[model samples]
Target chain A: MSAQPVPLVPVLAVVGIGLIGGSFAAALRRAGQVGRVLGVGRRQASLDRALALGLIDEVVDLEQAARRADLILLATPVGAMRAALEALGPHLRPEALVTDAGSTKADVAAIARAALGERLRQFLPGHPIAGSEMTGPEAAHPALYHGRKVVLTPLAETPVRARDWLTRVWEACGAHVLLMDAERHDRVLASISHLPHLLAAAYMAQVSREGDADLRLSLAGTGFRDFTRIAAGSAEVWRDIFLSNRESVLDELAAFERVLGELRKTLEDPDPRALEAFLEQAALARRLWDGRSAMT
Target chain B: MSAQPVPLVPVLAVVGIGLIGGSFAAALRRAGQVGRVLGVGRRQASLDRALALGLIDEVVDLEQAARRADLILLATPVGAMRAALEALGPHLRPEALVTDAGSTKADVAAIARAALGERLRQFLPGHPIAGSEMTGPEAAHPALYHGRKVVLTPLAETPVRARDWLTRVWEACGAHVLLMDAERHDRVLASISHLPHLLAAAYMAQVSREGDADLRLSLAGTGFRDFTRIAAGSAEVWRDIFLSNRESVLDELAAFERVLGELRKTLEDPDPRALEAFLEQAALARRLWDGRSAMT
Candidate 1:
């Protein structure tokens, strides 16, 4: 980074312009850092929404955007990143720096390296710790990444030039970037992010069955609302993460099951002291975290 | 009953004036529904705060307040409800319509019936669908019950005159009242409210112990934040509820574990059709309920 800010880039290409991608384009445009923003997506409606919402200056073909762009941002779902890379791999300009907003890093980085080898050194795999239950172009918000942490998982072979440029881009997009290894990134997300989703879905499904089964859901307050709210999110998106990050998620899930089993035993024995201790520790840990800042 | 809006009751006693009771006192005073709101609590600090915050006009002895007041609202923890009722049982005036904010209803109503039979006709065991993670007198808010449901688990033997008077009181507090049998009330809450808490706490306990847990927690965004938020709430309050309403809560927990076990098996295999069906069913049920409004 320079002591003085660099001049605004002229053009930027956002591949797979969904919620994250669309929001990136909108935020950059709103910041007036990019003279022209181009969005690339398979769906015409998504491209239209991106253009209409002023998220981008134009809808450009993937290859055209890749060739003309000063930077390329991958904002597709994690499962789609590999296929997206295959399409953009050959056309990616040598001068252009590539980065992604996929949640998982190991698979994306590995796929990029396998597809483009030395050229992949230019690609930076990053996950922004910001999102909502809502998805796609309509849900995009400019302030989504403001004051939020963005994690970049870079390989040992990753180019210093690319990393610097990528950091600058994220900072311009109003994110505080942290860099870590791909395996570590995957492990962390599996425990905190992926496991929560699985737990919510499984738990919610228990109450969701049809019957004269007693449910005072009408009387559920904000606590219950907030807790189970994510259970209603996109299942396909969660399924993709769970399947792709299976090993890490499974490891975390097993850890969780063990804790739950212990809790179950404690409950059975009516150990008030043990139960209270468990709850107090959790409350303390949660209280130490900043309440206003959204935990991603 | 008066032909006009029943003349505002002058003397109101808030029994067990902790979080909800203090807030109720404040709301009543703010709305000018009561001239002298008496607060009864076992704690001195809470009584002091209630007086300082102007939640009550006076801090009085429970029996003394019961003798003087036209209305009594119980806001104690579920476990303390029976003890509170037993202490105040003989002193409750025939004209004073009693209600509560306890989570569980069956036991409270049963205890009221057994201990204060004729006066039990005056007791309307109610559960207000309002709360925050924060507790005690300080966390009290006037708007907590706004747009939320207040379930009146009126027993079969509850007198029509008393039930009507109790309904008027709940209405004055800005709650939408719904009548249901006590048993059904417990069952419903077990599924919608209690089950979700168990799931969230169990999941939080499970995932937070793994390697790289801190890193994963750092990456957990809004999704994880909302999901685990209730896990940070008062452990004493929840633990008491679980123990007090053990039968219903345990039954719900068993149901949840069974469902989760099924999901675990499904995850072990990649049966797309079955998983999609499971997700679709859950999504449909969620959509059927009003987003956040249904929660209260």
Candidate 2:
């Protein structure tokens, strides 16, 4: 790609220099859209690794990040966002617009309101729906967000200029940015993302608990591997996500149970036609979704 | 792979020219283990496709296949197994070994017992745990079973000589062969393969029925794709599988419900630690399985 005549953002500070944060900086660097990246994190060794890995130019504290950054992105676990926002609130520059890469939006929006007070208007809650099983600076790659969806949940007081600018920046990272309200974003994520994760993990654990667990695992083929892939996601991150969006997740689980009940009825009925119809509904929809996804 | 000095089987008849049958033929051809592959199918077009794809040498009927072949493999969907066996029963040679690649073993074994009569001694109930979402001869590959698992659930009257020969044939296809009782094999498969497919299909159908389904599907990323991959399996095959092993599958579903109940309790309690602990169990078990699989 041709380098831009001028960087889009003079300085970008990334909090929690893990896969999301490090990859954001790398994507921006590849696009030649950011002049410098300042990494902030809880651990010093991780920052050093980020520097060694060329994921950052320098390491800085939250106070320095707030004072110097043209834009600041919080890529921490949602549980850590409130503290990061509180630390940044006191020193955050007037021109700086803040955003996050947290999975849950409503909780992060609430945290920003509570922590940043008046500066909360500058915060746009965003989540990049990308592979997240791998974490840390070592797992970061420039193309992590390429052709992925980045959902931005902007508040009422959020500036149009900042929203449009953030959208352009994510577009430079090869992400398609979509706008949604925080509550709706959280609910949508609970249905499509969080509930699936919980189900995979739960199924994996359940199968592992069986008396013939070893034989079952040994016999598991591609289907089991694919279905339980999300079960390998980081425990801490998922815990925070489940707890942060408990109500939505619980609601999705109930929905899943209802579907299972219907499936069980078909099985118990020994109704071959009904069973085939149920499975065919899923097969048809899955094929249609694949076709739809291929276009976009 | 190097060709065997002599063809392992002089004449091999495959009673279904779909993915499983075609792949088995292709795999044996690659290993130089079969002299001629006689294909039998209900559809002439599919049989022609199998021939054109080089998955079979020629098309033949069940009587000709039984009369002329040294070995026969019934790779048709489980629901069609009894009819196929019945067709072969009258013309079958006593020395000719018969094996099946059906997903459900207990039902197949029972069907064989009734149809094959005294010739049940020669039948081996087998399942090649390979990628199965893709069907038809075009989806078959010579290396489809490479580094995969093949489980054989032999009946009490099954001859050891035939069992040994089938094991070697599958090994030539680069699969690790394991033996289990038919009932246990069904239960193990129910827990691992069948249950995952059912859950994936059910989840995909449920998501498609949602009011915000378009939005939800648009936002779905790699996780959704992998989690629902198995829902794309042939509906008739999966329906037959679920019906054939209904009791085992229903038992697994009950087990799954118990696990989901525990998960729901933790979420409702808003117990972060308990939630984290639960997820960690699955993550740890899944990781261990991956490691074990890598080694084996």
Candidate 3:
């Protein structure tokens, strides 16, 4: 018996070939599942850089890229997704299986549905929960997606053919694929990702203002540094994320405030039992949680 | 040309041969600085393990260990420092240089001063701002102190000879030594170290308490894991630290609450400019701060 032949090579058009886009191109190219990787970006410099770096075979016009490619990947920021969808409307082939690398799914899926109509049957909004603190094509690497989880949010009208194709694309790139609804995805991410960024920034500000300014900084050691490392992310990108997920973020903030309040009471009065319980649960959860799911 | 001979090696006694103590012994052994490394602990099992692992040359009685050793390193919890000082006082040699790896400096320094009178001159209260989340003698590695900062809190009555000797010991163990006052060290660490742990514990508690607990955990990634790693530390140890540094920790907590309140407002209403500034400052601070100074 012989192994069955592989499916037809899909032509992939990657928009905004930065870290996510560039890494996807590298993974797809290495897997040999995609043919003729075409990249589309606003900056000619980045497009030239992507081509030079072998992240893509060529840079092509948006309409031409959309029409010719069998699959189109929207790898831009969530804020830019709407505009890109609008630009892609004129030439997106109805059968092309469209996907994205946006962090938030609900908004992107809505935008794709409104802009692409019947062609939206091919759309699968995705959030590949993988990345580094560093950004841009220079930071892109082939192994960046290995063992990572890629979340896909498919519409009710999405064809089984498109869903299977999208799953194959992600699996070929060495990602663990999972399905989620758009609203639930945003809510869960708000509690885990967006809220943590805000809290890191808030705590850092507190450290600068509340502590004996000179002494606090002087005494600050590794514990503080490790805790606040995430505060080192891009301001514009974080600001947009926080804004886009505002309601869920606010809900998490309020929940956190209640927890903090309880801790404050325990602190003021110094209850050993209460404090121990707080740390015990956290330790259990952290130990049991698999950190590999966050490969991006 | 004649070169001055290197200083004679000190017979170093490491009390409570756990992670910090075991690492200190191993580091000294690796650097070929100790004439003999003597291990002293309340538990016979730990002493045997430490000797077998070559963290020390011999396991000795606490009294005999203090009497024979030239350098005494009390690498135990802050809660145990006072008791250790009392036990070692009667047997400590007159010219012995004593130091500790306690997180809280003021209380330990005070306890040592009140217990040992003139013998205090031989004691150089020190805190090696270094450790990992892991524990036990087995977790100890010779490279634990490399490129880290070790803060020493020497009283005015502390002899210059003892301070200088202890500084050499830390330098031999691969640390950059710095002078700090006890009160100042407590306040500074309260903000940077203690507050962050409390905040993380609180954050984890809030997220874990949600109705859809599994959903919240499902979305947690690297940022969440890194942010909450320290929250998984020993509850007994952290509880003691927070309580010992109560005043400073309380003050820092209040400051943190104020900033968190402001951030909550920003999130609730969505102020991009204000949020941007908050993130920019945090990012700038984190990028500029030297990570080597974080060892505490």
Of 1 and 2, which scores higher on DockQ?
2
Where is model 1 more than 4 Å wrong at Cα?
A1-10, A29-35, A134-142, A213-215, A291-296, B1-10, B26-35, B110-122, B134-143, B291-296
Report the Cα lDDT for candidate 2. Answer: 0.90
Please state how well chain A of candidate 2 matches the true chain A, as a TM-score: 0.96
lDDT, candidates in the order shown: 0.76, 0.90, 0.82
Candidate 3, residue B131: the lDDT equals 83
Could you tell me every candidate's TM-score relative to the true structure? 0.89, 0.96, 0.92
Looking at model 3, residue B186 earns an lDDT score of 86
Q: Model 2: per-residue lDDT, tens digit, B1-296?
A: 25647788889999988888888999999898889999999998999899898889888899999999988999887878888888898888878988998888999999999998877887889998886667788988999999998999878897888899989999988888999898998899899989998899889888988999999999998899999988987788789999999999999999998998898899998787888899999999998888888886
Query: lDDT by residue for model 3 over B161-250, one digit each (tens)?
Result: 778877888898899898989888888788778889988888888888889877678667779878888887888888888878888889
Candidate 1, which CAPRI tier? medium
As a whole number from 0 to 100, the lDDT of residue A296 in candidate 2 is 78
Supply the DockQ value of model 3.
0.66
**What is the lDDT for A90 in model 1?**
80
**Rank ordering of all candidates by TM-score, starting from the highest:** 2, 3, 1
lDDT of 1 by residue, B22-128 (tens): 87777766666776788888898888987887788788987887788888888877676677777677887767777888888887887787767566677789988
Highest TM-score model number: 2
Ten residues in sequence with the least summed lDDT for candidate 2 chain B: B1-10
Residue pairs in steric clash, candidate 3?
A130-A296, A131-A296, A221-B294, A222-B294, B129-B295, B129-B296
